[model samples]
Target: MIGLCLGLAGVVWAQLPVSSFTLAWDHTVEKIRWEEDYRLTETGLVLEEARVRGNGAGMEIPEDARLEKGSWHYRRPIPPLQPLSLGRTPQAGDYQLCVEGDCHALSHWVGAPDINEPAIQLWTCTRGGDAQ
Candidate 1:
């Protein structure tokens, strides 16, 4: 079975039995909400869609983005990534990983990161392989 793996420093920390999830966070500079939906595949993770409440600084809404309610929605046609890297910092707050309809802080799954650590890696892995 395919699942999502959370790791740090090349070591797998947690394997979630989920095929799809949403990663949400606040823009560090803009202080606006941003969310990305992703699904796990045999080869890697696929980003389905992305939404941002407001754009500023480095967060610019795509020209094809449509205004839906109070947010801008768009789809990025990027190829599946083997491993997705996420930056972590106390100042930016924790990332909310939403599965099904429930959302939880990423730290809840892998514990808090060390100050020296800079990023958390996410990718798809087979249950019997690198994932436990």
Candidate 2:
């Protein structure tokens, strides 16, 4: 019983590291618009910020959305955000930002579809600098 409890504690502690999530529009001129960062906690995932770039603007997440079973739940109604499904899937180079120790790629369809917005593509946590 004690051993089982210890193992469970270790698992919980391992999840303490903060992970970032970003939503950016694929544009021809600017490339990216808004990028958001989220941190994981014992209670749930928290939104750190939603950064808008160079004359670009977007709707902000009303509150911190908890990550439940790999899905995010916001407190209030949010704007649309999801991947484009014009039939042909995008290649890695089309939307992937690669760097040392980290890579930001378009997020797969995870979580509820009804609330997912189609205008913004997801980005993984980056190590250093902007997505190139």
Give per-model TM-scores.
0.93, 0.30
How much does candidate 1 score in TM-score?
A: 0.93
| lDDT per residue as tens, model 1, 1-132 | 888889865578888889999999888887899999999888788999999998899998999999899999999999998789988877667899999979999989987755677689998887743632
Of candidate 1, the 10-residue stretch with the lowest lDDT total is 123-132
Please identify model 2 stretches exceeding 4 Å from their true place. 1-31, 56-101, 107-132
Model 1, position 54, has a per-residue lDDT of 89
- Clash count, predicted structure 1: 0
Each candidate: how many clashes?
A: 0, 4
Q: CA lDDT of each candidate?
A: 0.87, 0.30
The list of candidate 1 runs beyond 4 A from truth reads: 129-132
Model 2 alpha-carbon miss at residue 89, Å: 8.0
